[model samples]
Target: METVDVIVIGAGVSGLAAARLIARGGRRVVVIEARDRVGGRVHTDRSGGHITDRGASWIHGIHESPVAAAARAFGMPMVEFTVGGYQPDSRPLTYFDARGRRLEADAVRQYAADIRTLNAALAKIIAGAGAEATYGDAVERALAEQDWDAERKERVREYNDRRAQEQYGVGMGELGAHGLDDDTVNGDEVVFPRGYDELATNLAAGLDVRLEHLASQVDRSSEGVTVVTDRGVFRARQVVITVPVGVLQAGDLLIEPPLPETHRRALGLLRMNAFEKVVLRFAERFWDAGVYGIRQLGDEGEWWHSWYDLGRLHDEPALLTFAAGPAAVATRTWADEDIVASTMAQLRRLYGDTVPDPTSAIVTRWQDDPFSRGSYAFMLPGSVGADHDDLAEPVDGVLHLAGEATWGDDPATVPGALLSGHRAAQNVLGIDIPVSELWA
Candidate 1:
């Protein structure tokens, strides 16, 4: 049996980050990954002469993001897109009804205002309500208190649903009202001109990473921890389980002696929302090149709420369609051709008949992937701060949990995952190293 000071499971950003920090502290560490490659959910696919990020792409907080920091350290090129940069005369986000009619500017402004109202109401409820109060309940209460007509209420619901799905990978119904607060550092967002995977690759350099090693069992004892995998068994003084929340929820790995009741309960509290991306490559750009994104208000079945013009970033005639939560779950049942066809139908509704069929298409099914059952973690209603803290708590000083889910303030982001890993490594080593020092 191979032994090390620390064993990091899942070579995603979190695991890699943990391993790097541990190794820097002169502790022996090894990373076991189920996939043949690293970057668990930060996969960048290059096919048909275009670079497409099959997993996460954006640096949500460019200035303070750990991912962005890593990118700069790696000398990776990044490009920033102005929100609503295109369509100078209209709102940055162009909204169209189901029949493809552009929503009036007044209606758009009203929707935006309603969103602010809903958020303010949610904030008040979260401040006073118990952990069980869901965002859905908040939305319902806010809408009921309003004097808007049925049409306006419906519009508000539709807009909120789309926002929840896009941001949290779930609808408002599944999101925890208190947890929905965005605590991320604010800055201009940017994308990797080459690929986001470069950040993962840069972090993984010189590390002892074992690919295609699926961990089946993790048995912790008084002395240390033992991780059983399909390939081999690894013994380490401490183990960092950085797998996705969905993988933990599936109970795919057997934790001998069972995890604590609190941890188990916390697992149930956090929900893994489905999210996927469909990349369509066209021979030529048909949409406005200056616009950063497009949102369809009345889409059938939430198949797609919005799309980003890759041409703006990579100078390629490609558009990436985003689907999350229920829509992402529904898309799992669709074949590639079906997904492409349906998305194309939606595009046609927006751009008219002149929109051409894509020369090639690729769809990502993160939910169906065994390694990652869903994209990331979201707080469900009835969750409390202690829930995430308990989930991240180390067991017996040997078992540690680290991932985006463990990152309370910044879940569902690369920086969150990386920060969680750093925290886990710090916990395991019993040392405090500033994040700036790590980047330095």
Candidate 2:
């Protein structure tokens, strides 16, 4: 039996970051991970002569972000994530009609303005609605009250659906109108051209990371905590559990005394969303230059609605698209060939029949991954942001919880997970630590 001052579960950014801070504070720590690799959901695939991030890809925001600060310290180069991400006004895009004909520049810009107006209107509805109201209901009422033409209404509705999938991995109706939280920074979001998982790798350096060690149970007491794993058992003065909320919800790892009532209440309200990415590579750029993003209102539900020209981040000729919520659920049993074929049909609808086949393709099925269970956390009706804080509270002041789901301000982000770890370390040390000691 091995022992340490602290034991951290899950080698994801959260766990690694907590372990790093604890170690730097002169405390012994060990990290247990079920997978052979680090960066639980920040996976980067460098196969087939391509650098593609199959999981989390953005810094969300650069200012006041620990992850961004770490990237800067490592001298890593990053470019602003300016592709038309739900909010199209951030960057110029090549817009297409249902028939694949590119829309005029003025028309595309108009859509951006319309979306902004629509978003503002929806925000007001949410603000005025009660906690029992769903975002889907708010969107529906807003759209119903609009006096726009049928064609314009249809366009905005379609774009709104796609944006819902991209942001929440589910329909707006599935999200809580009063509970949704998206805390943003003052600066632009950014991504690393090389890989997003490098942060996890660098953070894991010099730490005691036990790969392939699946934690099955945690028994806590006043004196210490005992962590039971498939490989062995270990004890520590305290343990920080950084596994995904999905894992805890599924009872994959049992806590002997169970979580506090408040923790369980919060946990019950949080849902792990289905957000998957598909990476397509071609021999050469196919779309127009100076147009980094391509959005199409395809027919038949538009399974693939948005795409980005990865060349902006040095992934030349590669395209990235996301399928979330219902779209992702619909493709749960889809094979690789089926996904590529279906996506190709959509591309052909927009790029004519002469479009060539991609040299390679990478698809993610985070929903099916047992270790992660799903991508990230989203709130349901009757839930509130304070639920995240409740879920993050340390049990008995010995069993600390930390993860993206545990962070309310910036949930479902890499920085959220990274910062949650630092907070957990602070909990373990029983003091407030400065940011310089953690990231510097």
Candidate 3:
């Protein structure tokens, strides 16, 4: 067994950040990852002369986000999309109705305002919600009491549920009424047109990384923590477990002597979420550049409810769409050809028969990934943000936890993961990392 100052498990952004900062602080750190690649959930593929991210692509928030800090630190190009997350500015949304007729710009603005009003109303329901309240129940109850017409009511319901599924990566019914236990970092969002994984690559430079070393168990004794991996055993004074919450929730990696009841209960209260993305590359652009996002209102069920103009992002003439929660899980077993054709059907509903077939396509089914099992973690009915801290609470000063799931604010975002890593590094080593290095 080899000994080091610290052993960082998983080479995702979180693990890399911890190891990099620790190593920078003059400590010996080693990172062991299961996959051959280092980015983990930020997987990017540069296939067919196009940079398509199979996993997370957006920085989620730009203001005060560690991802943005890193982008500035590394001098990476971060382009702001038109409709940026939940705080989209005054951008034109080229939306259509279920009947395939494009909605008027004023109608679109009114629809946007309606959703905002609905969310505000829902927030009040959540505030007074009982202990057993679920987001689905809260949403339905709010909708039921609304004075809006049937069409307007249906549009809000579908948009809220499906979009919530994408955001939290779980069915609304399974999520806590308090939501994902996330505090939105106030700002616009950005995406890396070059590739999302470059940040990982930049952090990995000059670090000791061992890829394809799947960690199976973590054992702690009198003096130190020992990590058992298929490649070899690594011993360290402290071990940072940066694996996904889904991995821990499923007991995929065993921690010897079992975690404390608090940690176990916290783990049990949190649920893994699945979010999958697909990119369709066409020979020519059929969508409008002025329109930031395109979606169908009043068309419910597991269909393509939303799509973004990917062509504008990188000038690749592609469209990006997603399926989350139940839809993502159900689509895991779907054939690629079937999935492609179904998405094309939705496009035809908007673009008519002249809608050409995709020249190339990229799809991701994160539910099929054994490492993550799902995308991230969402709050169950009784779970709260504090549970994340409980799970992150170090075990006997020998084990440390860092990941998006462990972070309360901005959870499930890349910046959240990176900040968690920096916190772990600072906690384990008691070193001072300039705040300027983080957000300035």
Best by TM-score: 2
What are the lDDT figures for the candidates, one per model?
0.81, 0.84, 0.81
| Tens digits of lDDT, candidate 3, 7-115 | 9999998999888888888889999999999999998898778898888888766877767877888888888774535332245667788778888878877777877
Error of 3 at 365 (Å): 1.9
Give me the displacement of residue 18 in model 2, in angstroms.
0.9
- What does the lDDT read for residue 283 in candidate 1? 88
Model 3 residue 245 CA deviation in Å? 1.3
Model 3 alpha-carbon miss at residue 292, Å: 1.3
Among residues 3 or more apart in sequence or in different chains, the pairs in candidate 2 whose N, CA or C atoms overlap within 3 Å are 136-172, 136-173, 169-325
TM-score of every model versus the real structure: 0.93, 0.96, 0.95
Native-to-model Cα distance after best TM-score fit, residue 238 in candidate 2, in Å: 0.7
Stretches off by above 4 angstroms in model 2 are 178-180, 183-185, 298-301
Question: How much is 341 displaced in model 2, in angstroms?
Answer: 0.8
**Candidate 3 — which residues are off by over 4 angstroms?**
82-90, 180-185, 435-440
